[model samples]
Target: MKSILTMLGIAAALLAAWSARAAIYDAIQFGEPGSEKSHGLESDDSEVIRGGLDEPARILLPRAPASWQGGSVKFKLRVNPNRQNYVTLKLWGGDVNENLLILHADGRQVGYRSRGDIGLLDYGSPEPAVPGRFYYVTLPLPMSATYRRERVEFEIVSTGRIWEPGRTFEQYQKKMLTPSRGLYRFYVHDHSYFKPPAEDRQGARPEPVLPPQQPESFEALKERVNRELDRLLGPDGRFTNQMQLLMAAEAAGLEWSRACRNPEAVRRIVAGLDNCYLRWREDPSLASDDRSAVYPAWTGFGPAAEAVRLLHKDLGPYLDEELRGPDGQPVRRRKAWADMLEAGVRHLAASRSRHPKQSMIVDLNLYRNNRGLRLLDPSKGLPPEVVLGCLYESVGLEPWSGPLDGKGKPVLKSGGSDRLFTAKRLPKEFGYDGNDGELPALAAAIYQATRPEPGKPGDERILGVLREMIRARSFFRYPALNLAHNPVMRLETVIGWRDMQFPGDVTYVQRPESGASVLQAAAAVLEPYSTGIVQQMFGERQFFPSLDRQMEDREFRTTFGLLHVPEHYRLLTAQPASSSRLPMSEGQPDFVFSDEESGVLAVKYGSEILYASLYWRAPHAVNFLARIHHVTPVLERLATVRQEVEFQPSGRIFVRPGWTNSGVGAGGLNYPDNVRSIHAGETLPIARLPKTAGTGQENPLAGRGDFYKLLYGPYLFAMNASSREFTFTTPKNIVYKRLPDGGEIAGGTVLKVAPMSTVVLRRAR
Candidate 1:
């Protein structure tokens, strides 16, 4: 009877522990990549647990010594299956804070994550439905005393076709045995554990101090990097983003080999080169306005383009020394500029759909030589740059798909009038005759860099012209990217730009094995050919006030040219040849307001209306213009509204019927009172009120910005920037009773705030 029970337990352990790492039988040493020392700690009879038909219900993972710290528990799972089967795995941990336990099935199947604020083992997602092979799972168990007793559990279940009632034993054995090929490997290393004191279990001890590994000398580092690159990237020259970046690091290593003679020098050079190249290669320019595009140029410091020429020149010399050449010149081993660029283009082209917002083809031909709207109307066909430029422009901030105003001739503002269409005549019409000179310099620098000559002054010329030309652009007039295009590629060159705000954290990290993991750590990969950025950028659709609001605020009508015209303007990410500001008649304002005193008090912009009503405790404020005669559809006329209001005696005033009799003076009316009583009144009158609300004791008018729904959907929640955190609010029509707080208001048709940050009312399925 005791043997029967032991066998049953063993079978269960074998089934469940198929994918988990076997318990350590011998002491092992694992540390930094190259230097691992194994201390004699493993006992010959160390517990060996196998998962077969059934897995054990609990596991006590290895923990760091109470005094000696710095150890991690690494375990592997071995699953034997003939056909795909659904499965779920749970892990127990010491720390209350949720720790990530990685599960890899078929090298691609990733298990779901469970996170919490407290210490506990987490149950993960059900496994693959159709599993055909043995799978491996790796879990990291930190060596902390806080974790006393816990175990990992595996729940394997069927998902697809159910087994028939009758099946031969041999048939089932064949199905299961064919898939279970070999024993899975599990490794536990000391590197994963943080150091801790021997006795204390609750408190964390610092990790054992280890000296920083000094990098090899430039020559040695270069050789090692080359070897590593060869091991990772074979002859194909095609690699994942991770591989490509590591190759880039190798390129940096080569540069370091040439730039620095010492080991530390290589480190410094490579560190400085990391972020700039990867990001710049992704997006070359990030101009604020549509009138200019910037590209990092290697021209200025005493013929910098020569560096390219040098690479071309010495490349043959370097290769010839290592290998035989056909014509006595060195053989070219690395990919040339054209080949690499072509490969990049091909890769992006194949995956163009993945990056819809960015253009795969950077055809300067479509932009630089475009003569008329018919050829280059941004609204009609892709201008190439808009989709392409966003790949760079949206870094660290939200992506943008707005019009390509930054690439064309600067619409020099007159400053006299804000409306460019009216106050500023076309540059040609005004006979300015000055072409945007920045373009030629940019073009020249690119030319020189791509084709630098030995003993020629091309490099100096390119750098000088590009440096001066870029500095003259409008964005540079303000605090800007402080770009200094010098030939030297020296760090000092950027120090003087924009009060010396140098670029941030641009170092590259190279890991030989996993490409995606490393790239994910740095930044979300902006798929070069994907429209995802465009969709996210242009998705921020802004709705305007209803027609009634336009009728009320003459200034808005004139400023945006949305008055009587009844036209709606959708700001497209792609720039159109021309766009009208008129509001569409079909367009509806989100809200409508009216009062008994004033028939149609005023309409407000969506934001303006939301702002006025944010303090729900306060009455709504609706300020309106009285004189229809003063309103103008022309934007030029609207420009005078601000000035006229500033100089007027009362600025803007409202007179009521019982002004003198009811203690209501014949002056500006109560805007807030009008807004609140809008629905209460039977028939409201329309009157123009004073534009400037004086410093009176009662409700005064501040600009429209002061009032609005400061908390709106899609407004990112940040520790800073937002004071009122965004709590999911129930949608209208669908009834909701519960607030985010635990207390429930009602439940029959309640708003359920799902785990996903979206509002769900009773109507929501």
Candidate 2:
């Protein structure tokens, strides 16, 4: 009997140890390369000082302290008698810069503020104050804080300050505190009283939300895009006349690619090439009638300019100057004229491989990067042959042969200079009898120089070019891949979903099976990287940083899910693999499965996300994705559950006085299916809820006590989905609760949610 008791105690202790969980660290100050300044309201003031206009400040705050786990924290400026000057201060960030709450230092409550509220502080007059004065600034930890460290602003609103004749005040703190470490970031509160700060004053900031048009229906958005392209490209498509028509055709293909339109549009754009030939025939100035005669390729200057530079083996000069290679080398020039000629031959090879007819019109639009096709164009004056030579060296192609300069050696060009063109000089006084042999010979020379080394393997350039065309949008344009996509997304919506899964120990796996790509597609148009074509389009950022090690494992699995969080953390993908068991995939892994055994499941009730990952061997796994949206009720439910308990809304609900409760739950609804135990209370039918159920045993939560009963009280509504607005009454004891997709919900207010959407209902205060 003694031995058995000891064994039981050991077993209990082991179980408790096994149940312990750790929170993931949020890295806030990880300044993304170009992401630091997308929409302005600088992410941080780590570097900003007094008079630091146009200078960026970086602030990073540590991840939200563990204490903020289930609660929302509100941060605001607190004014003491000493620092109360007529200066303007602006605060941004919590929920996209909207002012959520305001409180006086002495506890004078101004109530919860909305976006329409004026919370900015402007100092019109300067006051004297001692240094190191402490100001009480409180960030209320409400029950719904998402990011660990959000950017805060404290701007000096008054341009000039007035001082009393008798005395002067210590100059205002020259610079606000910006984090140099940690992830939480804050920026100075400038531009609160007037125009936007300098950083945000540049080109039109892309909207946070994507115009509500689908990319599949490009018709509505394409015309506006084409017009913009036309404006950027002058009448003559090419920036110069040196490029051959075939090369010009290639350039045209690149232009079609930038728009990322349907293949049909790309084809139509390319077909217009024939029109260019006729125009060249009629316009003597555009393309000369005589072969080898000097003619301006300016007709190709419009959208195709980037392509024209490729013919000379150079891409865009400005872009080349901006983009840096991994080795920090400035890759911007062609070496020798021989190298340029070789590049021409390579182009010809790729062209012939695709069109068999030897049509010089290579549709690079279809090319993928892996094949070795260089779609990123360099600038002009560099010979294409030079770049070809570099490629030759990289792949061990063959021996090179081309004209040498004064020293009598093969021309070897380096990046950043127009060496190829500088080396060649046409005769000072040349005659154009329409048949100068020079130009075409140069073109032909380029073609001959690019022959593949004596039969090593298939042409990489050919394959690469073909694949690149098909994946134009993937290269340098995916919003998800770009760090800037974050701020761009934050501008429109308050929340986004980033799901991470690791099959191996480190690497994040984006299996073709998980279908997480759907979210990428959804965010494409909504993020800043998306071509701003639709009005309904907005931006929202999501980040999934998978540890690098476990990426390639075919037998990959992990136990990760979001649960117990306060706010509505959107779902990016299905749950990850169970903790104790490895996730398995049979058949096509990409298809969506209804089987809970396949992975985990997340149940969203109001703003709360309850997630669980199951395994045949392991007991269970749960995690909180964000702060619960409806906190009072959830806490109440949690309080009641002993080991497990059923979760449900409270009895008291609120909507507009006259709003009808008929047809309230019309869309796909997600709710708790089973409860192990129920706290006897007046259950109210707030509105019709779509059929919902739990995958676990019937009444999975039955042991819990009245901890779930605390949720019943007056409620507020947040209408999230649908646009329709109507009213209805609940059965005598029932009530209606509405949650708005945007804005705050008032107690007793039934927010109108359009048909086919979600609404938030919190127990009324």
lDDT against the true structure, each candidate: 0.21, 0.21
Please name the candidate that would achieve the greatest TM-score relative to the true structure: 1
Per-residue lDDT of model 1, residues 690-731, tens digit only: 433342212212211111211111110111111222332323
Predict model 2's lDDT versus the native.
Answer: 0.21
Give candidate 1 regions above 4 Å deviation.
1-207, 212-219, 225-388, 393-765
Error at 602, model 1, angstroms: 44
**Root-mean-square deviation (CA) per prediction:** 30.6, 27.8
Tell me the tens digit of each residue's lDDT in model 2 across 1-765.
323332332333223212222111111111333433332323212233221122232332212332100111123332211110111212211111111112222122211111101121211111111011111111211111111223322221111121212122223111212122111222221111112233331222223332232232223223333443343243444322222233333323333323333333333333333233234434533321223322122112221322332232323232233222234554332222212222332332332111111111221111111011233332322244544443332211223223233222344442222211100111111100011101211222123223232112324552232222112212101111112222211010001011110000110111111201212221211222222211111122122221111123222111000100101113222222222110111111111111111112222233332222111101011110111111111111100000111123323222211111111122112112111111112111122222342221112111111111111123222211122443422223334433322233443343343442223343322
- Which regions in candidate 2 have their CA more than 4 angstroms from the true location? 1-94, 98-215, 232-251, 254-306, 309-765
Give, for candidate 1, the lowest lDDT window spanning 10 residues.
635-644
Prediction 2 TM-score vs. true = 0.19
